[model samples]
Target: MSIEFYEEYIESNKAIIYKICRAYTHSKLEFDDYFQEVCLQLWKSKEAYNHQSKLSTWVYRVTLNTCLSIIKSEKREVDTVEINESFDHHSDLEDTEAQERLNTLYMGIRQLKKADRAIIVLYLEDKSYQEIAEIIGISMSNVGVKINRIKQQLKDSIVWKSLI
Candidate 1:
């Protein structure tokens, strides 16, 4: 693909790329690095894309695979910092509350096994079971089952954290 097309493609899919990167990395530095790596991988594999799947679906697969590989190679445990500490103290009550909820959810997501994290993030992005199965290489029925189980796991984690 031409450089222009690649740039446009990345821009169009930036949101999903950032979301996947954030799901994998806790710190901003790590997020930036992971995002770069995902983009690089996408560019390198551009010629290999055979149009068997939608461009978005191909991007999802590449992003998830790149993140999973990076985490596996590094073998570093995610840091367990207080989620609120990363937020601004001056935000109003409503904004703070919303940020806290989002942070809590992300914290819960980070605690999951990598594969489960990928599944949940895609599900949260409103991907259909068929699309998720296509991206994750699982059966459609299996995606539904895994999604239900992952939802319960996240709920339990959030509730358990609140009790602490």
Candidate 2:
């Protein structure tokens, strides 16, 4: 596809890219790095898409594979980066607290196995279990079970936030 067409796709899909990037990122740089890797992989794998599945399914499959490769190759553990006050642009002070909670939530999500993490991301993005299963090549029941477990795990992790 031409650059213009790809650019349009990127714009339309920015939310998916950004949220998935956040789910896997350890730092701001890692966000950009993984996103670029996903874009590259998408372009490279474009020829491999068989058209049997939807375009969104193909993108999710490619993105998840790229993220899993990064996770395994880096062997990186879950760690939140130090908050850079300079990057703080919240309009209301109350919103900063919400941001912290969201950051922690994502960090907890990041601790999950890659498969679990993918399910959680798709779940939080309000994707149906059928869609998630189709994209990840899993049974719908598996996706349903995993999302419930991931939600419980996340709730369990929130007990110690006052200490942080």
Candidate 3:
């Protein structure tokens, strides 16, 4: 791929790239580092694009695999956090409530195994079962099963939290 093509690709898909970075890294520093590494890997692996899947799917596969490899090599501790993204347009109370719920949901997700976390993140991003299976190298049926189980686990966690 030409440099122009790679630059344009990164520009257009920056959000997905950043989302993967955020999902994997706990701190701002780590996020920055991971984002750079992902970009570098994408550039270096440009020749590996086989057109078997959409470019976005290929990007996801690359990003997730890169993150998994880094995590394994570093053996870094996973940090569980309450996610807080600001929406200034919303009323203060509504924003607070939304943020809290999102945080709780993310916290529950953080409890899952790494593989489950990757699957659920793709599902949340509205990727189809087939696409998710392709990216994660799992069967479509397995994707459905894992998503159902993960949803139930999240619900159970919420209920358990509420009772406490």
Candidate with top TM-score is 1
TM-score of candidate 1 relative to the true fold: 0.86
| Deviation (Å) of 55 in candidate 2 | 1.7
lDDT of 3 by residue, 1-164 (tens): 57696676677677677667666665567777887888888999878999888988888888888888898899865644443442222123456778777656666776677888889889988999999998999999999999999999889987887797
Q: Which regions of candidate 1 fall more than 4 Å away from where they truly are?
A: 1-3, 77-94
Instruction: State the displacement of the C-alpha of residue 82, model 2, in Å, after optimal TM-score superposition.
Output: 11
* RMSD for each of the candidates: 3.8, 3.8, 4.3
Report the C-alpha lDDT of model 1 over 1-164, residue by residue, as the tens digit: 46786666688888778778887887777887898899889989888899988988989999999998898889866534444434222223477678888778888888787888889999999999999998998999999999999999989989999999
Tell me which of candidates 1 and 3 scores higher on lDDT.
Answer: 1
lDDT for each of the candidates? 0.82, 0.73, 0.77
Q: Candidate 3 has what TM-score?
A: 0.79
Q: Considering TM-score, which of the candidate structures 1 and 2 is the better prediction for this target?
A: 1
What's the TM-score of each model vs. the native?
A: 0.86, 0.81, 0.79
| Residue lDDT tens for model 2, 1-164 | 57774874455666677677767766767777888898888877777988897776677778878887887898865444333322212123367777776777776766676677788888887889999989888899988888888888878765654466
Best by lDDT: 1
- Residue 139 of model 1, lDDT score: 98
Error of 2 at 60 (Å): 1.1
